[model samples]
Target chain A: MVAIADSVPKPVARFRFILDRRNVLGSIMIAPAILYVLLLVGVPFLMAVYYSLSAYTIYDPSWSFVGLANFEDVVQDPVFQQTLYNTFIFTFGSQMLGLILGKFGALVLLRPFPGRKFVRALVILPWAVPIALATVAWQWMFDSLYSVINWTLIALGVVTRSQAPNWLGTPHLAMLSVIVVNAWRFFPFAIVIFLAGITAVPQDVLDAATVDGAGFWRRNYQIIMPMILPIVAIGLVFGIVFTFTDLSIVFLMTMGGPVGATSVLGFAGFQTGIVSGDVSHGAAISLFMLPVLFIVVVAMLRFIRRREV
Target chain B: MGSGGNKNNRSVTRRSFLKASGAIGGAAGLAPVLSAPFVSRAVADNKSLSIVQWSHFVPAYDTWFDKFAKDWGDKNKIAVTVDHVPVQDVPARAAAEVSAQSGHDLFGFNGSGGAHLYRKFFINLADLVKETEKKFGQVTTIGKQLGYNADDGSWSAFPDFYINFPGMYQKSLWDGIGMKPDTWDNLRIGGAKLKAKGKPVGISLGHSNDPSTTWRGLLWSYGGAIQDAAGKKVVLDSKEAIEAAKFVAALYKEAMTPEVLSWNDSSNNQYLASGVASYIVNPISAYRTIQQSNKKLADDIFVIEPPKGPAKQIMGAASEFYGIWKFAKNKEAALEFLKYYRDHWPEAFKASEGYNNPCFANLVPKPMPILANDPTSTPPTKMAILQDSDKWSAIPGYPGPATPATDEIYYAFILNDMMTKTATGQSSAEDSVKMATQRCEAIFRKWARRT
Candidate 1:
């Protein structure tokens, strides 16, 4: 018996034959993704670069080519320097705190216990809920006049009403507050990464380590950590990238204040580009993040590729 | 062979029928898409207007304004749409609209109008201004400066209303302290006493409009400004500016809490309504809010002129204006709508509960009936102080037009940060002034080249 497809039209058969080609099929499959990235990411990125090299502003969309003048100007700015410094501190502080919390959280969840699934679901809430809503809720908690933290502290006689700490007001405290909120938002993601890496370690390997007289600490730090380093490193790359470029928490919580204590490159870019309407300088400020993030991604990806098991 | 032939014929018929149906269905599906441009053009060419503005702090104002817009649309046989965004999001929203080069026909500037900043995207409103002036007389000084370009002699926006920033104080708190905040000295002294008693004055020191306006008032009151009257130079590093910074630092240290450093535009309003605040610099919306939420506190709240400083007693006013975008599709309708809206200024003011002060001198004349005898107010005349507020009011970049330079500085919160730095002991008054001056010089120089 002949195949039913044999009766198909010559054009349809020819088109199916072309679709069946491996390279063509592969290309067609990824066409949407490539188009998505090109349109959304590539176009905007190129536009930003173009804007950075020009004297474009919302008031005057002249697009006059200025040739690095904006970068030179922002580089010389004392505030921009402060912003750069704050960005590093914010990113490092949040990433470190997140990874540490995530490691411990994963270890806790790893042990079999009652209501483990429920507890795991709760851990995912911070990462799952909408960030804007969460940030607004945090804003109220850190409010100057009605901070719940201050209320509790005062109630506990830890501090008087007059002396209660202003979390989002004082420069140091504001920085610390933003870092804490960012870490809280990012830790759940880290926890999942850690859980995956830990579970991927074979039981036989653990059993062999145990037989070799390796203790919990020894296995965790010396054996398991090195084994999981590649995955954790990948997670760290994402965490750093997200935390470093974050604008929402800072914007909604402190607005880069009390005197730009919590100002980061992303927030500064938005303030300059959007609020101040200096598009060229804003583009420059935002583009400054690229090199740092690029380096991180390259290093982690290289490490991941080398450690692929 | 005959049966096989019949099966093949039936199969071909079904396929042909499917192709015919698909062609018909495809046309049906694409009909709306293909005709959309013509439909939109027909609507856009006539009888349509759209507006975007900050959602008023007073809820009743938005309700009344939307209804007013719909009524006007109905009367004119036009389709009108209104969009409201949070006050804090207005600048970003405007920036987005300008970037896209397409948005509502008329855009409302709620605070210090950005007519000068985004002037290129806005239509020249000089003719509208002249027409309004012919009927209602000259616009108020601050109103004109807020939306007019001195160089081109063009009005970039039509001045609508100004919100008077008064000294909203807790009557009982001041009475208990045996003082009133009539002057800067008295404000500091009384505020300190109140602070010692656990009731501190609340004014924003953060990057929001409240701080932007309030700090400018303080700066001007000390004989300092961001620019000279020519609006050509940065004059923020003056001795008087240093003094203003020093005075504010002292005030912050002695009279206010550190929390004020994180306050937004609405924070002070919330602070005043909380009953723990002795004083706050805000519009009548604060009092209006408490009237609905806390009547007892509302009764204790009263408005007064902003504290008189050593040099002058000008108050920083938050003005509202409307600009027609250059890319607007319904220019004629928008202009007509604005004229109609202007004719109903008194009604708009009433809808705002007297919060909206007319920019036209004759639009809502002196001793405004609603303000002088507000039935909703506790004493029925408590809001009378705002009747003559325009006399003491100054827009952003006072002593000069609101130029691109001042727009940059105001939105950047440069002055607010300078004050905050000194007040928080992060920088000395001189250093803060110097730093802020550097920032302002950069901005002024940039705008100088462009303008």
Candidate 2:
């Protein structure tokens, strides 16, 4: 039967003989992407994971298999614990502030008001400015001796002549200052997202709710909020991730100082790995965030999925 | 025949697909590899030197390599180029370059990071010095001292410049208050007057890597140090350390702005430039920075040897020693460049506009141009002030010692955190010092064991 089929030009044989242009085009299209992901993402990620398990100090080229030693050291470190606490505080504080301010700003700007375009552009100014420049500007504004805020407070009799507030000196205040800076810098992103979400709300449903004697608070809380929950969740996730992982602001602003008061995990990792030449310890510190970040991401994804369902 | 043709077509299509995929893969991977050879060739062909050095050093020396380049290149048919990088990023950049085994031909570093970490990356300059000295009639004593070694001449550092932290005060401010801050105690009294005049005496209690230097100076002046003569163990928790801490705490309480804790690395310059602080312990770099920003403070600002403490000893931090990379492709050229930098001290000093202090004892015999007592250059009293620098100035680890671990602890933990705790009233000086000492001991032991 095989010999007979080979001899005969059957319809199936004819179809198989023709080139599948779709398959060729599909392979050609995906070739670059496959190569990109493997080279860029897969290779580096594998290296990072491999390095994470090894004692890879930049000072020394000789790396030994330390197993989970780096992780154990990180867990045992008091500085790591402090860093975790600071990271959480920074992430949560900045995200919450960003959410509130961003939503409010979005709502106010959503309506057709005078100078709305100008105000919208101004709102984005903080986000648009380079992080280093913005942090430097904030550092100057919060200067201990000659801060504009201190001068204003003193002039207004809010603070006494001798009671100048050290905005970035004390630990608590330094943390607060960094959180404020992060919130100010990133809130514009939230605003833009929230604004898009708000605009996407159905006008008919809102009108119906208003006709049913729903007040602004009721309409916003019950109607508009549920509709925009997914967007808000996305904004929150991004805010948390960005804040938790950020080092530049803390580095430039305070360097996690005034006694490690504002030392976040990201900054700690950088300080240990790069600054102090303790790559193993730095890697350990950086990986400490994995579990917490995993928990955050998982929780957010579940919420979004549930909302979608 | 038809079946054979069909089989051949399928095989060709598969081969073509594989070839296409392979081409894409090769293109993606080949860029960095292809560029590597070119980079290597460029590095080999280039006779020009690029250095990431301290900002202050650039002004101190005239990089008149154009003449040398023309002469040397004409003689040897090789060209030379030089560029400077900001000092702060030098260590990290050098580390990256060294790890990659690429980048700058030379990098300048300070004593702490330069000696501790950068040493591992740098080539031993002992032979280079010996060879250069054989030709140049014995290299400068400072260079030899910086590169000295008893264990088969394994030293790597090449001494470039040195500066001491003198108590830079507004002389007019002190004289106007009828208060002389000759001693550490006197600073408290002077600080009180300054505070009364609504200007708190500025001192850098700021959390910074430099804080270790400040703390060490205070500790040394109080007869305390991170280690003793033997350099066997940590001594940060001693009575003198406690006393120094208490003194600093009191000073902070009375004289310093609350903002000192948050001040950036440049805060010392800011304090003096704004005329808010009456005194600060800074290098001549601070003086230069302030003069550049506000020239009015040039004469009003005075440099005094660090005030005497309970121990009656004045102490200050020394700047970093410049070293050549061990794996530097142009090691000979780098050494030659350093030799040029050292030999032309007078020219370098004149070019720097008298900002850099010469490391060589002979070259700085009477204090170079701007530091001289000549009426045309600077005030006679101004030159007189630097006279005590030779006596008071000492590197953190000097007189047969290396305290890399202690220095690291001092910067990373003690100065960055402990100082703030004491100053902010969060912890007592004794408690802070005690805790810091225990921490320092652990680190020192760990490091000692490793080395």
Candidate No. with top DockQ: 1
In model 2, which regions exceed 4 Å deviation? A1-52, B1-46, B57-83, B129-152, B230-232, B289-297, B374-378, B387-390, B397-404, B410-413
Model 2 has a DockQ score of 0.31
Quantify how close model 1 is to the true structure by its C-alpha RMSD in Å. Answer: 3.7
TM-score against native, each model: 0.93, 0.84
Where does the lowest 10-residue lDDT sum fall in candidate 2 chain A? A12-21
Give DockQ for candidates 1 onward, in order: 0.53, 0.31
In angstroms, give how far residue B425 of model 1 lies from its true place. 2.2
Name the best candidate (by TM-score).
1
True-contact fraction for model 1? 0.60
Interface RMSD of 1: 4.5
> Tens-digit lDDT track for model 2 on B1-451?
5663454345556678999999999998997787896687565555655555655544535355345434554444345555455654655666577668887666676544345455577777666556545544444433443445444557667666566667788888899989777788889888987977866766666666456566677778888777765557776778888888888888888887676787765787777888877888777667767666777776688877788888765665555566777767676776777776666656655565545555545555565566666353245456566644656766654432544454456446565466667877888988888877766676566455334
What does candidate 2 score on TM?
0.84
